[model samples]
Target: MEESKAGDLFAEGVVKHYEPELKKVEKQLNELTSKQSSLLKELQKENVKFSSIDITELTSLYQMMKEYHCRLIAMKKDILAAAERSEKLKNRAMKLKEYKQNIALENAHYREAQMKREQDLIGKPGQPL
Candidate 1:
């Protein structure tokens, strides 16, 4: 019984750990995706109104575009890693569920045994009136 309870706690700990990791990855992904999207919108706005811009401004815009491209690449890698970790998190949750169910079953068996013993004691024919 103690062993079963310990196993349940260990499984719960594993699930708790992976859940935070998954949230961190998700937050990072959201930041990167949002930055890339904002850059795209800014570029679109420039396209409609910047054909007559000076050379210095054009150079600055080009640099920003290059940086955005690099960030997008990094974001893609993060998303892939996050997907893999999500699968691991799901498996961990399943294991935790199974461990808890097993413990409950063991506890129920113990209670049922106690009840049977009480019944036997009450029915013993040699007992005092």
Candidate 2:
């Protein structure tokens, strides 16, 4: 039916719209992860030489590492939120597809019944062939 087609299209559109947003968030997460890894490596190297480092420089490095860690956590949360939104859109699309199939099946059954009625009336009293 026209309504079924419209609903399917709408659901697909929503899914398509969210897909780009999901990809962007995932890319951001990947970049943040890479930065986090590099920061960790640097921190490890600094830790190994902690006793020989100047106190002020060490403090500055620690503060910068903490900020990077916080940002990494925020990126991870954004990715999770985006993923959840994308999943919901996908589920809606699937449901719309199922609805379209059901509509088609119902239409088929109705048409078959109408055809059978027409066949039965072909030679009936007062009904034209």
lDDT for each residue of candidate 2 in 1-129, tens digit (9 for 90 to 100): 999999999999999999999999999999999999999999999988976879999899999999999999999999999999999999999999999999999999999999989978675787655
Clash count for candidate 1 is: 0
Candidate 2: list runs displaced more than 4 Å: 1-51, 124-129
Residue 83 local lDDT, model 1: 99
Which candidate should be chosen as best, given lDDT against the real structure?
2
RMSD score of candidate 1 (Å):
39.0
Estimate the overall C-alpha local distance difference test score of candidate 1: 0.95
Instruction: List clashing residue pairs in candidate 2.
Output: none
lDDT of each: 0.95, 0.95
Q: Residue 100, candidate 1: how far off, in angstroms?
A: 0.1
Clashes of each: 0, 0
